[model samples]
Target: MSISNTTNFTNPSDFILLGIPGLETAHVWISIPFCAMYAIALLGNSAILFIVKKEPSLHEPMYYFLCMLAVTDLVLSTSVVPKALSIFWFNSRQIDFSACLTQMFFLHCFSVVEYGIFVAMAFDRYVAICHPLRHSTVLTNLVVAKIGLAVMLRSGVLVLPCVLLAQQWPYCRTNVIPHSYCEHMAVVNLACADTRASSYYGLSLIILVTAMDMVLIAVSYTQILRVIYSLPTKDARLKTFETCGSHIAVILIFYIPALFSFFTHRFGRNVPLHIHILMANVNLLVPPMLNPIIYGVRTRQIRDRLLRLITHRDT
Candidate 1:
């Protein structure tokens, strides 16, 4: 609430994040689990990076893609969670104007990158299961690196416009953002200028990216399932299915809550403000925390290597 107002109107005002509105009394208690989840997300993703690097046998296209995913999760979570904790724990809720835009840029950029990684992982599985013979040749190290670079570049390029547009708008309106983080639409809404173009552009990005990635992932898995069923024996089918379980689980974890939050924020008029804001923050954090657990539990090589590292086994 410490806003500086001079008769000068050219300078952009700082944004006041209300954290989770209507739950102000419980902010300290609420931050406990938030802090725990952020800790787990950092440690889990770091462990994925460590294990994938240390184990030579783990150096395959699949594991390399996983390392990329771990890195993205680290960047995404680190950008938002600390700021959220500051608001919840210390009630430090003011964010600078340029800093807010930077936060929004990284939030959406890494989010898009994460979705792109899911698509790549799906393709990796499809190549392995559908075209087992050509798996190595089809997804060479060079190809994987290219895919990672393309995803990152695409995310950055596409998200830049949104931040730039937001910056140019005259902030003739209030500068209070109710959400924990500077979500794109929420910040853009505070502008007094006509923002219909910005609003639709943001929605288009969400729909287009989410829909395109979902379709690609679905097609890849469809081919994978067909190949599995065509295998000679039930045991073979089950084994192949096991290979995909982690990817499927991770996809579900990442997408479901995310879509829900996005949709409710746009359409669900009856939903409470606190729930809407809280879910948006939770969706981003929960996926990063759970992704490593899902992979470590489902991917046998990683689990075994993790156990070995824990036990310090030489043999």
Candidate 2:
């Protein structure tokens, strides 16, 4: 998805997704776990939304950010998994050029938005732990609304250009994408025109915004940890550390696979194609699936409510 200096442009063809490339034969089997992961993601995130709405005491900045994360995760997973399952389970591979661009947009958009939620959640922890006295005054409903709006706007603004560029690229080269979804790089590789613009746009957006958010998150957590350890009693320190541990776990789950997939896509020439693709899929699917589970297990409020709901079969 890129540009050409010439006035000539050829209409793009409908792209054929080759679902896992060499592993096409096993796509049916692959669909099983993918379907399970999607199901779990749907159920887990929906439960987080449900439990938060039901418990009055859970109304706070942290849970508000958790709700944003849950909703973003739901969008992130749903954007790709079902279509991927169509490719895997039923041999449905033809995606219209417009649809391909659309998928590329939303998938990348919400994926980045999901990372933004992580940052917001991190900041929530920083405030709650480091400045406990002013947490409410600082992250009030209006400020939370602003932060959520900022995350959505930042993601939408940054991602829209790439999808637009994808549409301009002349797609006379080939239409078969050798992966499960319409990844930015995969789509760019299909353009007959020079694609340096698309590549640079994508890399710049990822490096600038993602790297900035990560650095801010790291700084916030560093401040949080410093405050946690300074508590006069060991019990105080342990309890505080336990609260932030799950957030740290969520961070690791989000970034590790994402960075690896990106690295393999650009520099891992020696790596197998399917492995890279699998890593990309993991970057999208695993975080959404695990974020809720991690929060439910770690946050006492969510955990208690979830357990009670399960035990009582609450309406």
Q: Give the Cα lDDT of each candidate.
A: 0.90, 0.87
Error of 1 at 80 (Å): 0.7
Question: Cα lDDT for residue 122, model 2?
Answer: 89
Each model's RMSD to truth, in Å? 1.9, 3.6
Ten contiguous residues with the weakest lDDT in model 2: 1-10
Cα lDDT tens digits, model 2, 118-198, are 899889889889888999999999999999999999999999999999888877756778889999999898788889999
Give me the runs in candidate 1 sitting further than 4 Å from their true place: 1-10, 313-315
Among all candidates shown, the one with the greatest lDDT? 1
lDDT of 1 by residue, 1-315 (tens): 665333234346578899999999999998999899999999999999999999999999999999998999899999999999999988898999989999999999999999999999999999999888999999999999999999999999888889988888877657678899999888887777898888888889989999999999999999999899999999999999999999899889989998999889888989999999989989988999999999999899999989998888655
Pairs that clash in candidate 1: none
Error of 1 at 229 (Å): 0.7
**Between which residue pairs do clashes occur in model 2?**
none
